[model samples]
Target chain A: MIELHNVSKVYNSGGAPVVALRNVNLTIAEGEFVALMGPSGSGKSTLLTIIGGMNSPTAGRVIVDGIDVYSLSPERQADFRYEYVGFVFQQLQLLPYLTALENVLLALAIAPTPRTEKIARAYEILAQVGLKGKEHRLPSQLSGGEQGRVAVARALVNRAPILLADEPTGNLDRATGMQVLELLRDLNGAGQTVVMVTHDPQAAACARRVVHILDGQIVGDTVPAPEHALAPAVLPISQPAIEPCSNATERVQ
Target chain B: MVLLVVGLAIGVATAVALMAITEAMQADVAVKMDEYGANILVVPKANDLALSYGGITVGSAAYDVATLSMPDVERIGTIKNAANISVVAPKLLGAVPLMGRPVLLAGVRFADELRLKRWWRVEQGMEPSEAADALAGARLAQSLAIQPGDEVEVNGRRFRVVGVLAENGSQDDDILFVDLSAAQLALDKPDAVSLVEVAALCTACPVEEMVEQISHVLPQARVTALRQAVTLRMETVGQLGRFAVAVSAVVIAIGALVVLTTMLGAVAERRQEIGLFRALGFRQRHVGRIILTEAALVSAAGGALGYLAGMGAAVTLAPRVANVTARVPWDPVLAAAAVGCALVVGVLASLYPAAQAARVDPTVALRSS
Candidate 1:
C-alpha cells in the first residue's frame, strides 16, 4: 500500500519555481490496480513519480508498505525503489550493448541473489514476460513490442512488488499496446500492486479503479468492470485461443 | 603491460642514442688529449710555422735542425717543473704510403721519453730497439693492414714494424714510432722536430701563463699547454650533452601526445560504462581509479621499452660506427623514473575525463532510449 497526503512537488530551473503536484492526496491499498487518468498537464505523471520515490513531494508525507518512504534518506529511497518498485518507462530504456536477458540481469547485480543463480532468475523472468526464447537477442534485434516486453522483464527481474508504468504503450501501436496492457493487467490480477498513468481511457480501463484528475487535483475516482484483472500474462499463447471479435469497443485495454 | 612495454622501448631508445653519441665524442677527444698528456710543449717559432702549415708543402723549410741542439734541450730541461721531464724532441714527421693509405712516421728518443710519457701500452711484440725498425699504434697497423713482421715503405725507405701500441683512438694510434736519427735521415731533415713536449707536475695555477711566459722567454719558439686542449674537449662534450638533452625532450613530448590522445578517447568511449558503474553504487573515486590505472599501465610500458631500446642502441650500434660510444648512463634509474612518471602523468590526464564521467546524472542517463 502507498499514500500521498496532500503532496505538492515543485522544481526550480533557473529562478522561478514550477509546481508539478499541488495539494494532491491519494492512496492505493495492497494488491490494487490503480490507473491515474488525466490530461497531459493534469499532474498524473507527477503523482506517479512522487509515489515511485523518483522525486520527493515538496510538502506532504509519503508512506509505502508501512514505512515513511520520503523520511528515509535519499540513498535509502533509491535502495527502496530498487527493492520495492518496478518501473516501465514511456521509452523502453534498454542498454544498447546488453542482450535482452542481460538487460534484465543488470538489476540482479545489486540483488542479494547468488551470482550463479542470477542467470536462471533472469531467464525465468524473461519467460514470464512472453520473451522465453528471445533472451539472447539484443534490443536492436527485437520489435518495438518485444523491446517493451523486455523492459517489463527487467523491471520485474528483482521481483519488486509495486509496478509503476508511465504510459506503457506510449510507443506501441494498438495491437502491441493491447498485448502489453494485458500483460500488466495479468500482473495486477496476480496480487501485484500496479499504478499505471496514462492519458488513454482504454488503458485506464484495464485497472479495477481509475483515479481521474483535472489540472493538478483529483476530480473523480471511478470503478470499472471486472475489478480483478488478468494474471501477469504468461506468454499469452498458453491461454486457450479465442475468436477475433473486432467490435472495436472491446476496450483496447 | 603491452602499452608499458611499447612506451618503454620508445623512451629508452630515444634517451640512450642521444646519450651514447655525445659520450663517445667526448671519450674519443679526451683519450687523445690524455695520450698527449705531456702537459706542455715548446716548439721553435719557425718550426711552429712548419707545424701549422705543414700539410700544404711536403718539403717546406723554416727552423734549422742546428737550432735545436742537445744543449738547448738540456737548457730547457733545467726549469723547476722539469726535474722529472724527459724531453721528447722527435725528428720532423713525414707521410708514407702503405696499402694506398697515408700514415704519419714518427722518430722519437723513445728510450728516454718513455720515462716522462709512459702512457703507451704495448699490445703486441716489443718496442723498436734496433735501428731501421719502428713501433706502430694498433690502429695504424690496422689502417695499413700490417703485422709486427711486416715491412712498410716510408719516404722511399723500408722500415719493419717491431711492435704495435694498443688501440686508444688517439693521435698516437695514427703514427709510427722510430729512432730520431732514422726518421731525420729517411726524410732528409737533420736534428730538427715538428714539435717538442715537456711533462711537468699536474699542480695547480699558471699553466696557461707559464706556457705563455716561458715560450715568450724562449727565442723564436712557441709553448702550448695540455690543459687548453682538455678544456676545449670538455666544453665540446658539454655542448654535445645539451644537444642530446634537447633531442630527448622532443621524444618525451611525442610520447605524451600519444598517451594523451589514447586516454582521452578511452575516457570518452567509457562514459556510459562509467555511468553504469556509478549507478551500481561505485563512488566517483572508484571511477577515477580505473581510468588512472589504464594510463599508468600505458606509460609504464612505454618507459621500460624506451630504456632497453636506448641501451641496446648504445651498446650494439654505437661503438662500431663513427663518433659514437656505448655509454649507458643511469639506465635503470631512467627506466624506472620514466615509467613512474608515466603513471603520474596518466593519473593527471585522467582527471578531467574522470570528472566528466563522475558528473553524469543517473536520472537523466536512464531517461535516454
Candidate 2:
C-alpha cells in the first residue's frame, strides 16, 4: 500500500511562487488500478512523482507498505524506488542510444540477479510486451506503438509491486492507445498496483477507480462499474518466476 | 574524447620534448666542459703595445722583451692545490721570415699541449720528433703549399714539417708548432720562455686560490683564471633549460583549460542522461566514477601517443636547436611518470565537471524536454 498525506509542492521560480499540489491526501492499496483524472496544469503528475519518491513534496508524509519513505535518506529513497516502483512515462522515455533489449535490461543492471538471469528476465519481459523479435531494434527504428510496448517492457522487467505511469497512452493513436490500456489492465489483473495520470476519459475508463483533480486538490474519487469500462475482457498477465540460466550459457558473452 | 586526448597530447609532447632536449644539452655541456682546457693563463709581465683597430691587429705587437725563466715555469707546480693542476705547458712565440712571408711559430711540449687541447685534430703525420721537425698549421700549410715530409727554412735553418694541424678558425690555424728549445735556440734567446698554459680542474678545486698562490710566487707574472668565459657558457646553457621548462608549463596550463571547458560543456549537454542514471538508482559517486573513467582512458592514450611524439621531436629537433647530439633516454620510470602526470591533470581538470554531473537534480533534469 502507498499513502500520501498533506502533500504540497511549490515551484519557487524567479517570479511569484506557484503551488503544484496543495495538502493532497490519497491512498492506494495492493492490486488496485487507480487512474488520476485532471486537466493541464493540475497536480496529478506531481502527486504521482511524490508517490513514486522521484520528487520530494514541500510538505508530506509518504508511507509505502509500513515505512515512511520520505523519512528515509535520499539515497535510501532511491533504493526504495528502485526495488518497489517501476515508472512508465507519458513521453515513452526509452533511451535513444540503446537498443530495445538493452532498454529493458537497464532495470536489471542494479538488480541482484546473476548476469545471465538478468538477460533471460529481460528477454521474458520483452516477450511479454509483444516485442519478441524486435528486441535489438533502436527506438528510432520502432513504431510509436512498438516504442510504447518497449517502455512497458522496461517498467515490467523488474516486476516491482507498484507501477507509476503518467499519460502512458497520451502520445499513441487511438487503436495503439487502447492496446496499451489493455496491457495495463492485464497487469493490474495480475495483482500489480497501478496509479496512472491521464487526460483522456476513455483512457481512464479502463481503470476500476478514478480520482478527479482540479487546481492542486483532489475533487472526487469514484469506482466505476465494470460494465461501463471501455476495456475488453481483462486478461491476466501471468509472468511465471523464471529459472536461472544453465551454466552452459551462464557467462555474459 | 578526441578533444580531450588532443589537448593532453599537446601538453605531454611539449613537456617530454623539453625534458629530453634539456637532458641532452646537459650531457653535451658536460662533454664540452671537459674539453674546455687551459682554465688559467700565465703571461710574462711586460709593457706591450697591442696596436689594433676594430678587431684586426694592425701592425706588429711590440714587447719590452721581458721573458719568464725556467724556474718561473716550474714554480706553477708548487701552488696550493697544485695536485689539481693537470697540465702546465710552457710556450715560446716568435716570428720568422719563410718563403718571403712572415710566419708565427709556437714552441710547446707535445704531451702538455695535447692534454690541454683535446679538441685539436692532426690531419697528417705525428708531432715533431726532433728540434728540426715542425707541425705546420692547416692555413699555413695550404698557403705555403706544404705537406707532411716537406722541408721549410725558418730562422736560417731547414725544418721538416712532420704534420699539418686541422683548421680551428683561430690564431692556431695561422701558426706553426715546434719545440720550445728549438724556438729558443733558433731565435737566439736561450733559457727563456714566453708564457705558460695551465689546465686545472677548476670545478673541483679552488682555482682562485691557485691563481693567488701562483701570483704570490711570481708576482711579476699575470695569472688570470678565465672565470668569465666559463661562467658565461654554463649560464647560457642553464638559461636554455629554464626557458624550455617555463614554456612547457604554460602549454600544460592551456591544455588543462581546454579539458576543463570541454568537460563542462559535455556535462551540460548530458544533463538528462545523468538524471536518467540517477533515477535508475546510480549513486552520485557512481556517476562521478563513470566520468572519471572516461577521462582516464582518454588521457592514458593521449599520454602514450604524446610520449612517442615527444621523443620524435627531440631526436629530430634537438641537434638543430642546441647543437647537441640528442637521443631519447630509455627510462621506464620517466615514461611512467610522464603518463602519470597526464592522468593527474585529466582527473583534476574533470573534478568540477564531474561534480556538476553528479549534482544534477533528477526532478529538474527529467522535467526538461
Candidate 3:
C-alpha cells in the first residue's frame, strides 16, 4: 500500500524554479502492479524515485505502508528503503566488475543474514529470473534482456515489499521485452507489488493498471481488461525459454 | 595504489638512510676525534699574582703553586665516570741545565703517553724503554745535533737518546722526554707531577660530566676540558641529526600530499560507483571504511619495502658518501615504526577523500548510466 497527498517537487536550476511535479495525489493497493505512462519530461521517473524514498518532495508528504516516509532521519530513511523498497534503475545499472550473481548479492550486502544464506538466496533469485545458468557471467557478457533480468533479480533478492522499476525493458528487443514484461506480470500474480515507469504503450499494456500523466499531473487511470492486454509474444524456435517466477511473493518474503 | 606505495616508500627510505648514514658518520668522527689528542687536562692549581713596583705593574707571577703528586694522578681514575677514561698519562716538567744551556725536561710514562697522544710518531730509533734511555723532540735534537745513539747530560746525570720524535708542529717539538722516576731522581723532586693528560673515550661519553667528576676527585688540581674538540664534534653530530629531521619532515609531507591527491582522484573517478553503493543502503561510514582500508593496505606494503630499500642503500652508500667504514645493521624497531607511521599517515591523508565519497548523492545512480 502506498499513498501520496498533494505532492509537489521543485528544482532550482541556476536561480530559476523548475517544477517537476505539481499537486499529485496517488494510491496503490497492496500487491498491485501499476504502470506510470507519460511523455519525456512528464515527471514519471521523478515520481517513481519519490515513491521509492530516494527523493524528497519539495512540498507535501509521502506515506508508505502506514508510516510517513520523510519524517525519519536520513539514516533511518535508508533503513526504511532497505526494509520496504527495491529499485531497478533505468538502463539496467549493474556494476560491471561484478558477475550477475554478485550484482544480485549486493542488495543483501548490509543485511543481517548469514553470508552463506545470502549467497543461497541470491542464487535462488537469479534462477527465478531465468539466469540460473548465467549466474557467473558479467553484465558485459550477458545479453540486454539477460542483464535486465539480473537487475530484476537484484531488486527482488532482498524481499522488499515494493519494487520500483524505471524502464525495465527500454533497451530490449520486441521478443526479449515481452519476456521481461511477462516476468513482471507473473511476479504481480503472486502478490509482489511492482510500480514501473515507461513511455512505451506496448510495455505499459503488460501492467494490470495504467496511470497516465501529463504536465506533472495524473490525467487518467485505467484497468485494461485481460483480453485487451498485450498477449505474450510467440518465441522463436531457437530462443531459450524463461523459467516462470511462480510463488515469488511467498519465496521472496 | 602503486603510486601511493611508491610515494610512501620514498619518504621512508630517505628517512632510514639519513638516520643510518648520520649515525655512522657521528661514530666515525668521534673515533677520529678520540685519536686526535686528550680531551681533558688536569694541571697543578696555581694563583696568578701581579708582580708590580709601587705604581707600575711590571709583570704577573704564579704564587701558591700546589704541585700535583703521583697520588693525585692515580686518584683521577677513581671518579664516577672512570669507565670513560681511556688513558691517563702523568707528566713532571722542570728546567735542567744541559751542555751550558737550560733545557725543558718532561718526564712521562711512555706507554700511557703513547696511548694518550695517538698521533705521535717516532722519526728515528725505537721508543725509550730503559730508565737511562730518553727521547728528544725534533727541534731539541736539531739544536743539540743529537743522534739516536748519542748521550745527553742533564742535571749532571748521563742519559742515552734512544729515539727522536717527528715534528708535530706543537710545543712537544721543543722538549726532551724521559722516564718519570728517572726525572724525579734527577730533578730531586720524587713523587711530584706537574700535569696529567686524560683521553676520555667520548663516543657517548659526556666530556663535561667527566671533567666535573675528575675535578671532584682531584679538588686541589684544575681539571679543564678541551672544549674546542668536544664542541666541534658535538656540533657536527648535531647538525647531521637536525638535517635528518628536516629532510624527513619534508619527505613525509610530500608523501602525505601524494596520498591525498591520489585518493581524491580515485573518489572523483568512482562517483557513479559510490552513488550506487549509497543507493544500495550502505551507510556513510561504510563507504569511508572502503577507501581507508585500501589506503592502509597500500601504505603498509610501501612501508615495509621502503625500510628494506633504505637500509640497503645506506649500506651501499655510507662508505662513499659519509666516508664511514661501519656496516649499517638492520633495525627491527625502526621497521615497525616506519610501517606504523605509514599506516597512520595513509589513513589520515585519505580522510577528506573518504568523506567526499560518503557524501555522494544516491540520486546520481538514477541520473548516471
Candidate 4:
C-alpha cells in the first residue's frame, strides 16, 4: 500500500523554481492496477517518482507500506525502494553487457539470496515472461514488444508488491502497447499493485481504475470501462495503425 | 608527464646508489695496489687452485715485501700479461724506536725502483731512480719523526733519510724505500728475498682466466690480479639495478591501469543509457563481461608499451652513471615487461567499477534522469 498527503515538490532549476507537484493526497491499496493519465507537465511522472522514492518531495510526506519515506535516512530510503518498489519507464532500461537471464539476475545482486539460486530464479522469471527460449539473447536482438516484455519481467522479478511505471506504452504503437498493458494486467492479477502512467485512454482503459492528472493536481479518478478487456493478444509494434482505435484524443502543444 | 618524472627520478637515484659504491671498491683496489706493483704473484709453486686475495703462498702461506734483486725481477717480468716488472726490495717492516713505541718501518729500493714508474702515485718524495736518497711514506715519516736530511739508525748503520714515498696508502704509509743492497744487508739476508712484484696490463680477461695464463708464464712465482677484488662488487650493483628497473616497470603498469579504470568509471556512471540495456535484458557483463574485459586488455597493452619506453630510458641513461658502461642487462627488462603485461594491468583495470555497474538497479535505472 502507498499513500501521499498534501505533497508539494519543487525543482530548484537555479533560475525560476519549477513547481512539479503540489497539495497532492493519494492512496493506493494493495493489489490495485491503477493508471495515471496527464498531459506533459501535469506531474503524473513526478508524482510517481516521488512515490517510488526516486525524488524527494519538497513539502508534505509520502508513505510506502506504512513506512514514512522521508523519516528514513537517505540510504535506508534507497534500501526501501530496492526492497519494496519496482519501477518501469517509457524507455526500457537494461544492461547491454548482460544477457536476458543475467539482466534479471542483476535485480537480485543486493537481494538476500545465494548466488547460484539467484541465477536459477532469474531463469524462472524469464520463462514466466514468455521468454523461455530467449533468456540468453541480447537486448539488441529483441523486438520492441520483446523489450517491453523484458522490462515487465525485470519489474516483477524482485516480487515487490508495488510496481511504478512511467509512460509504459508511450513509445509503442497501439498493438505493442496493448500487449504491454496485458502483461501489466497479468502481473496485477497475480496480486501486484501496478501504478502505470500513460496519455492514452485505451491504454488507461485496461486498468481497473483510472486517475487523471492535470496542472500538477489530480482532476478526477473513476472506475474504467469494463469493455476495454479486448483480447489479450500478442500486439505487434509493427502495426501502429491500432493507436488511433485506442487513445487518439490526447495532445499537448 | 608525472610518471616519466617519477620514473626518471627513481632511475637516477638507482644509478647513483650503484655507481658510487662500485667506483669506491675499484678505487680502493687501485690505491692499495699502487703501494706494491704486484698485479701477479708467484711463490715456490703450489696447486693450480687460485689464491684468495693476492700473492704466492709457500705451502699455504703469506709474505709481505717491497723489493727483489735483478735476477728474480728479470725472471718474473717474462710472464705473458706481465707488461713491466720491478725488483721489490724487501723492507723488513719493523717499528722505528720512539718515546712510546717503535713505529713500523718498510725498507724499499731507492735505486732501480723506477722500472715500474707507471704504477707509483708520488705525493712528496724523490723518484725511485734516486740512489743515495731514501723516501719514507709521508704518513710514516710523520709518525716516525723522520724526514729528508733526518738521520735514523737501522741495524747500527747510521743513514740519512733522503726520500719519503708518496702517500698512495696501504703498504706505502708505514714503509721506507732505500737501496736494494742496503735493505738486503740490513735485514741480514744477502741473497734470500721476501718477494717480487710484477705489474701487468688488463688483457681484457677475467681474473680466473688470467690466473692460468699468469701461472704458465711464472711457474716458480705467484700471480695476483687486482681487478678481481672489485668484480663481485660490480656484479652485486648490477643485480640491484636490475631490481630497480623491475620495480619501476611495475609502478608504470599501475598508472596505466588507473587510467583505464577511470575511463571505465565514466562508462558505468551513465545510468540512462545502461537502463536501456536493462530493459533490453542484454546482460552484457554476464556475456563474459565484454566491455569491462576490453578495458583490462587495453590497459595491458598500454603497460607493455610503457615498459618498453621505460627500459629505453634506462638504457639511454645507464652510461650516465660515473664510470658505468652501458650494458642492457636484458634479463631484467624482459621480466619487468612480463609483469607489466600479465600481472599489473590485467587484474586491476576492470574489477572495481565493473562490479559497480553490475550492481546498478535496472528498475530504478530506467527511471533515472
Query: lDDT per residue, candidate 1, A193-219, as tens digits?
Result: 889988887677677677877778887
Number of the top candidate by TM-score? Answer: 3
Judging by DockQ against the true structure, name the best candidate. Answer: 3
Worst 10 residues of 2 chain B by lDDT: B51-60
Q: What is the per-residue lDDT of model 2 for residues A133-215, given as tens digits with 9 covering 90 to 100?
A: 88999999998878888888888888889888889888888767777777787788788888999877777777777787889
Q: Kindly provide the TM-score of model 4 when superposed on the true structure, using C-alpha atoms.
A: 0.53
Pitting candidate 1 against candidate 3, the one with the higher lDDT is: 3
As for candidate 2, its interface RMSD to one decimal place is 2.1
Worst 10 residues of 3 chain A by lDDT: A233-242
Q: iRMS of every model, one decimal?
A: 4.2, 2.1, 1.4, 7.5
Residue B3 error, candidate 3, Å: 2.6
TM-score of each: 0.56, 0.73, 0.79, 0.53
A best-first ranking of the candidates according to their DockQ comes to 3, 2, 1, 4
- The candidate with the higher lDDT, 1 or 2, is 2
Taking the tens digit of each residue's C-alpha lDDT, what string does model 1 give over B1-369? 355347545754676666766666666655554445577776554532433312222223543532444445555655554544434443456665656776677777877556555577778887777787788878778877778878877777788888888887677788888887788878776766655666554333346765755565566566667676567767877887898888877766666666666666676666555554444334456556767766666666665666667667777766676445325355455557656655665556557766666555334323434
Model 1: chain B TM-score relative to the native chain B: 0.54
